[model samples]
Target: MFNDGAFAQITKRDKRDAMLINLVHGEPIRFGVDNERGVAMDSSGRIELVDVVDVGVENLLVHDETADDPSVAFAISRLATAPTMPTPVGVFRAVERTEYAAAVSDQVDAVTASQGAGTLEGLFASRPTWTVS
Candidate 1:
C-alpha cells in the first residue's frame, strides 16, 4: 500500500492503460519507448494500463519485495543489467569468454620473464635460435 500522494503522482497526467494495469496488480512493471532508451519502473506496485502508447510493454522478469536494504538495491541493479532478450545470448557469452581469455593472457605475460631484444624478435617471429651465451 502506497501513500495517496505517491499513487497520485504516478497516475496524474499519465493516461496509459499499461501504467494503470501495473498499478492495480501490485506488481512493478517497467516501460520504455525503445530497448536502447531509458526505462521507467512503476514503483507504486499497482497494475493499471492507462496509457500504453508512449510506454512500450515489457515483461516483468524479477521483483523485489524487501527493497529497504543496500543488498536489495545491489541485487536489483544486477538484475537490471542482465540481458533482457535471448537473441544476444550467444554474443554475450562469446564476449565474456574473450574477456576471460584476455585476462588470462595478461596474467601470463606478467608472470613470464622479459627476454632480451634478440630473443624477443626471435620469439615474436617464431624463429628458434638455441644459443646459450
Candidate 2:
C-alpha cells in the first residue's frame, strides 16, 4: 500500500481488479485506480468513450511485504531499476522514476492524482502485464 492511493502487490494475483497500474518500484508494488465502467474526457476539448488507459513505466514500484530494513529496501529498489524484465511483450525496463511523497485519502483523489491528469487512466492500468513463466 503506497501513501499515493496506489495499491501494493506482492504477486500478479493481487492485480486482479486494478486499473491503469503504474510502476512504483517496478511492477510488483503497483499503484493504480480501481476498475470502473463509464465514459470520460480525452484531456483535449473532446469527449471520449473509454474502457482503459495505460500509464508510463516511470512510476514503477515493486512490492515488498518484508521490506522492513534498509537492505530490503535497497534490494527492492534495485529490482525496480533492473535493466531487463522477462515480459510477455518481450523485454522491458523501467525508463524513469516518478517521485511520489504525499498523503492519500479513502477517496479516489489519491488514485486520480497518481495518474497525473486525474482522468480515467487508472482503469487502463488493469491490463494484465506479467504472467508466471
Best by lDDT: 1
After aligning candidate 1 to the native by TM-score, how far in Å is the CA of 68 from where it should be?
Answer: 25
Name the 10 consecutive residues with the lowest summed lDDT in model 1. Answer: 86-95
lDDT string for model 1 (1-133, tens) is 8655644422454422222222112233343322222224456643222233455445342334333434433433333232231110101111123577899987677666464234555667784546688
Worst 10 residues of 2 by lDDT: 82-91
Report lDDT (CA) for all predictions.
0.36, 0.35
lDDT of 1 at 2: 68
Task: Write down the TM-score for model 1.
Answer: 0.20
lDDT, candidate 2, residue 8? Answer: 34
Evaluate residue 23 in candidate 2 and report its C-alpha lDDT on the 0 to 100 scale: 29
Off by over 4 Å in 1: 1-39, 44-50, 53-98, 113-133
Q: Write the per-residue lDDT of candidate 2 for residues 1-133, one digit (tens) a residue.
A: 4465233332345543332223233243333244332222335523222333443233223333334434434333333232232111212243333345323333447665675543357656766767797
